[model samples]
Target: MRRTKVDRRVKLHRELAEFIDMDLKMRGASVILCEIYGKWKGLREKEKDHEVVWPPMVIIMNTKLDKDDNDKWLGMGNPELLEYFNEYPAIGAHHSYGPQGHHGISVLIFESSTTGYFEAEGLG
Candidate 1:
């Protein structure tokens, strides 16, 4: 059977979720939610032609940890996670705190070579 783009994407999402789950477990944190999705990025060149790029595979992770804990964790940094990002064609990671500081969200962006429009998908 031939594998379609959707198949590949699903596999990628599963793998990413597993990897993140493991990492969070190792860090003694629990995942409240995990989302894997894509978005389109517009690029304008000096030439009159407009180009569209598939930005990156965004993995939004919501953890059970609070803002203070999340902040401390992020401040310490994750070398392993950094290494994983470095290994792939990725942008980077961003961490944000919830309004009430009850939970935190971490966004990991992995750059994709393909260019096209895609919808967001949630894994958790």
Candidate 2:
């Protein structure tokens, strides 16, 4: 067998929600990192920049994703995630906040077989 396995480390904004871990658990999604959006937060932490930097978003991915899968996702800017398993490995934005917090979240979905290349881009 090909033994297809595609995995990734998704970093989401902290101010997006109270508990993304709980949200993922509620939706039954595996979690790679369960900490707040610190890198960005840390930057302005000393300055106490309490501005909304990360929005509410969900990173629902089926681990064991393959390079081919990632290749597909790369093409599609952002497509629905739940339509086809191993096809479009993403589904929804789940929730979000203002521009500052809204932008930190970035995700893309693409499949080379059926939909060709579709997308919705975010960078939070």
Candidate 3:
């Protein structure tokens, strides 16, 4: 007998994400994405770690905003977006957004190694 357990009021939401990892060989799916966002905070000049390396990146910035606005993307503004660049420093934003920022960044970041923010902490 197949018992179908149904819980009322149980609305399900789905989250999707992608990233390339040597450990997973690009296919773990432990989660569509990392359940966590916050990693490190502030980094310094001198520290030793393995994950703290300049990884490859693939970005798709606010194409929905402006193709020329490399400095900025979306409402994030040229400055805020650049700040992200200087901080983690991505390769570039692809800007594959639709007419609205809703389907924003559909195929950028993640999987693209460098685009992902490196934990600011841990000096390296």
Candidate 4:
């Protein structure tokens, strides 16, 4: 049986979200999915590189993340799982400057998936 485009996407997101929640919790970092959008890449794209480098799926994070953290998260990816979703993992970070401190956050990336779902236990 074949799946429609929307069905494939929904399944992909469900699996991706579950994967993220499990890995983040294992790392002892609290994170929540704020939103997911298709038209925008992550916040740290270079001006000239604004073009969509990968697929349109973008996962917005509610908690701050660093490159190291993102690396760890990506490292947790399973090859079989990725193949199941037909997704290629890409990691991105957001750069923001503020008086309190700088906000350079890291995030997981995927080739195909829509919808953002986040869960957190304890975040500092």
Candidate 5:
């Protein structure tokens, strides 16, 4: 069972990498896949049992954007994009940053699930 779980994670990581590569190839975007793992901190005393948690499969995309138009690059006012992202997970957030000093506009994507804040933090 443990091996199965590990295998599944590996498969998922590969699939995501492939998908990102294909989807962004034409646009000249780069992706980095990483996981954020930590201990859970629950809202209530009963829920505060210390347990390891994996948040989500995080995808950080590096895409070129104009320095003069950060809002347009960040997709700050795009309701449709926001809605589409929200549909994929139990809970999630998206933000774009940069074109600062060295980096282009970076888009952060994550899968999230939550009961409360703690559950959100420990999104699996």
Candidate 6:
């Protein structure tokens, strides 16, 4: 059977979710939610100097994460798993309080080229 875009997306989401879950579990954190969105290429145009462009991915979690935490999350991944993506995805975290007393954070895994904008906007 031929694999469709949706199939590929689902596979990617599952793989990433599992890796993140394990990483968080090792740190005593639990995953309340993990979502993977479609590929985003907006940063490619924003950064013209780089030859390789990474897609922007967003993950929602129940725990707060800082810059160091984000860095560790990326660093914890094994090379074999990391090679699946071909390039490193810049990870950033945003703390947010939802309605009805809900608390969690939104993590934006994007390209390093757009780090300045994300950090300046307090999204990273």
| Cα TM-score per model | 0.30, 0.23, 0.23, 0.28, 0.26, 0.27
Highest TM-score against the true fold, candidate? 1
Count of backbone collisions within predicted model 3: 15
**Off by more than 4 A, model 4:** 1-3, 35-124
lDDT of 3 by residue, 1-124 (tens): 1232232212221211223334334444353234333233323425544353344333333424443444433544434454555654443433344454323442223223322443222112
Error of 4 at 91 (Å): 14
1-124 per-residue lDDT for model 6 (tens digits): 3578889989997986676556556656543533211222333366645443243444445443332432332221223223433344434433344332324444445543333223323432
Between candidates 2 and 4, name the one with more favorable TM-score.
4
Per residue, candidate 1 scores C-alpha lDDT tens digits across 10-86 of 99979866765565566565535332222212332346455433344454454334235445432213344456445
lDDT agreement with native, every candidate: 0.44, 0.33, 0.36, 0.39, 0.42, 0.42
List all candidate RMSDs to the true structure.
Answer: 16.2, 19.3, 14.0, 16.5, 16.0, 18.5
Off by over 4 Å in 6: 1-3, 34-124
Query: Which parts of model 5 have CA positions greater than 4 angstroms off?
Result: 1-53, 60-65, 69-81, 84-87, 94-124
Kindly report which residue stretches of model 3 are placed more than 4 angstroms away from their true locations once superposed. 1-55, 58-74, 77-79, 106-124
Clash statistics: count for each candidate: 0, 19, 15, 1, 0, 0
Report the lDDT of model 4 for residue 1. 36
Worst 10 residues of 5 by lDDT: 31-40
Please write out the lDDT profile of model 5 over residues 44-77, one tens digit for every residue: 3476456534444333345433444434343332
RMSD of 1: 16.2
Best by lDDT: 1
What's the ranking of the predictions by TM-score, best on top?
1, 4, 6, 5, 3, 2
